[model samples]
Target: MGHQQTVSTTFTSAVGERIGASLALVDAELARRYPGDPGTRQPVHTVYVPADAFDAATVRSWGEGALAALDRHAPDAASFAAVLGIPDRLAGPVYDRVRAKLRREPVEDLRIDFEDGYGLRPDAEEDAAAARAAQLVARACAEGTAPPWTGIRMKCMEAAVRDRGVRTLDVFLTGLLEAGGLPEGLVLTLPKVSYPEQVAAMVHLAEEFEKARGLDGGRIRFEVQIETTQSILGADGRATVARLIEAGQGRVTSLHYGTFDYSAACGVSAAHQSADHPAADHAKAVMQVAAAGTGVRLCDGSTNVLPVGPRERVHAAWRLHHGLVRRALARAYYQGWDMHPGQLPTRYAAVYAFYREGLEEAAGRLAAYAGGGGGAVLDEPATARALSGYLLRGLDCGALDAEEVAALTGLDRAALDRLAGRTAPQD
Candidate 1:
């Protein structure tokens, strides 16, 4: 055999940078666009009420009221299970936890809707409604009954309705600021975005408001609704979600999927429009991948089937809503739109059950992964992040206590906190 020289591999930082430089740039961009960990108290559901019907005092009691409905309709875990079609063994814990959570923090996020929920009124009446919403928000703030997350969703900014949408937003913000400073955790939601220009325009409006109102430059953060096909697909034929988030210029904090509108845009029949429909699922999956690891929050669409009819019919509606919520939970989309107060108990029931079922297993796997111990379960960095987030969310929602988490994972409170990246005490 002829002698052949062996090739040697050499290590060099310059070579490494040259080979992976685009990745560095990509990482930097991702970091810049990423929103960071969501708040510990992120609401499992955002309840929407027509802006005109918003009442500060009554709004505070909506959660309890939802609980009351549950009490009347399905007082025990067995009855709740019967309504949701889940085994009592599965429903029991969720039922108990949901009741407690409703008592503790019935509503986490609320949107006083000025769009679909509040149909277009005369210009003057719309402005008055805006003022009323601001007044209610101010009262909620002062009385300490406001949810940790609350916002207003104005009309869509399409050509025909653009002016009305802008006016509503301007009027609402002006009233909110003049009444009392902006409520804590306030965000604005812009619905039915069809183009990046709409997002840019909204961001510009927010900037102007911040400057004119003497608010912080980025204080007027908003969420874009991915309701239209155009919002999901960019002009260049790529996912528009990241572009939408990018266009917000850090003023965008979340993206909400509007189930009915999105399904309708896909040409699905009105009767078939639903949260778990294939079209809706595809949209949300695209959103998940596009916004993954980016700080921008993702919310699933609403189940419009309200549990409010005759007894049997109401129970049927509740079952439908519960299935939708459970489907969303299985897909790891925690936040969703709850159109009616009657949906709250089922929402929490589904969410709590999802977490409770996975809690012990997730905690063990996370501990083993974090500790680098040999275990049957393996975890990627993303999985680890998700695990930490899962437990922290449970803690925030009152579903899991620090002691319970520590005990389950064999990690102390300090370890759990560090995993959750909690540098400061959670509010």
Candidate 2:
């Protein structure tokens, strides 16, 4: 772990640090796009947000009032307590309900969002909520209050320009620091990352925020919402994401496929924005290419149509958490989301099963290789060759325990020792 940490710190530059982001070496950009190919069978870490929750009237009201309190907070005992209590008082029920739902969700599939998961709108009332949510988000990141991962759709730079006086994006970040001293490593996702410049600008802002807030700037992660034609097929589209990271100092952590916006960007029928659709898959591949090309995590957007009726909902839950989730995991997603509690179990199972399956496959290969006493020729097309990379990918998921890895391969720590000397590292 220590060695690995050192390697990451070396490779990943912190925000605002004078680190150089070099992508000029890749030569050409993505040669091929991911046909929204979910990938080689692992659950993508799904950050589920409650878009509908933000629509509720009460949430909107809470946003306005939260900021009013922030504006007048002072250096008095009463004021300080009032400030401390604000999050608990205003965000308590909202957080509790979300937390409870997460806990009870049929699966341990992780869900991340704030103020109900969607980005804050620019309306006056919602500004305060956005600020509060930002603070809450920071606290969660700093404190590990929930799962290890979470994502937020912060205000787009364009949106900020349109909103006039109050810069909601900055407020959101401020709230985060005030809430809990940057307790968490938050993944701030930007919507509609159309041009490389947009991506670059956002990265710069993120880096600035980190420096200003006194947090490890590079530690502040990011996910780009790929939803524009310019990002996919434009003349520079192939290299758009590449260029963005190069210019922005390489802070991108993941590239997410935004289906709805992609459909529109493609000038296709919006009604047919299903993941299974050929066009949607094409766009996902574009995103995958960008991600794969740049060595970042790739995630697909949520399936919009959800099951609602009792039986349908149950089945819907299964289809998503199991069918889709399993399929996605098998395609090699780090994790994926169950939008509702009902879908959680299947999502969890699929994610777990992915790593478990891989571990077992790897163990068998390594054990057999050990038995061969280094004389075994690992047929590139067969068990040993396949298992090498296979096992490593399983480890990447960070889902399995050492014992679990051992169980899958029937190899104890001692056996692994022998194999490591005999085998080469898998890709």
Estimated TM-score for each candidate? 0.91, 0.64
Worst 10 residues of 2 by lDDT: 30-39
Best by TM-score: 1
Error of 1 at 399 (Å): 1.9
Residues 1-427, model 1: lDDT tens digits: 7999898888878888787875888878766866466444566878888887888655547777888888889998898887777666677777888888777778888899999889978999999988888888887888787888878999988888889989989988888788878876897899999888889999889888888878888888899999999887866788788778778887777789999889998999989999888888889998888777566778888977888877797798888888888888778787899887788888887777777777888899888988898588778877777788888877777667788788878886557667765454566
lDDT of 2 by residue, 1-427 (tens): 4564433354434643432335333323432222222233233445455433432222223323322222233223234223223223323332233223334322222333433254455466556656655655554446444344444565454554424212556666677667755534455666666677777777667788878777775766567767776666767426465554455455776776666777866777867765556786776665655565354677766665553445445444445435555555555444443454334333433444555545654666576675664433463334453454455445444445566677666765434533332233221
- How much lDDT does each candidate structure score? 0.82, 0.50
State how far residue 423 of model 2 sits from its true place (Å).
17
Task: Quote the positional error of residue 274 for candidate 1 in Å.
Answer: 0.7
User: Judged by lDDT, which candidate is best?
Assistant: 1
Q: Which lDDT value does model 1 have at 228?
A: 94
- Candidate 2 wrongly placed segments (more than 4 Å): 1-44, 50-123, 138-144, 159-166, 215-217, 235-239, 268-271, 357-359, 369-401, 408-427
**Model 1 pairs in collision:** 34-295, 35-295
- Stretches > 4 Å off in candidate 1: 1-9, 12-27, 35-40, 412-414, 420-425
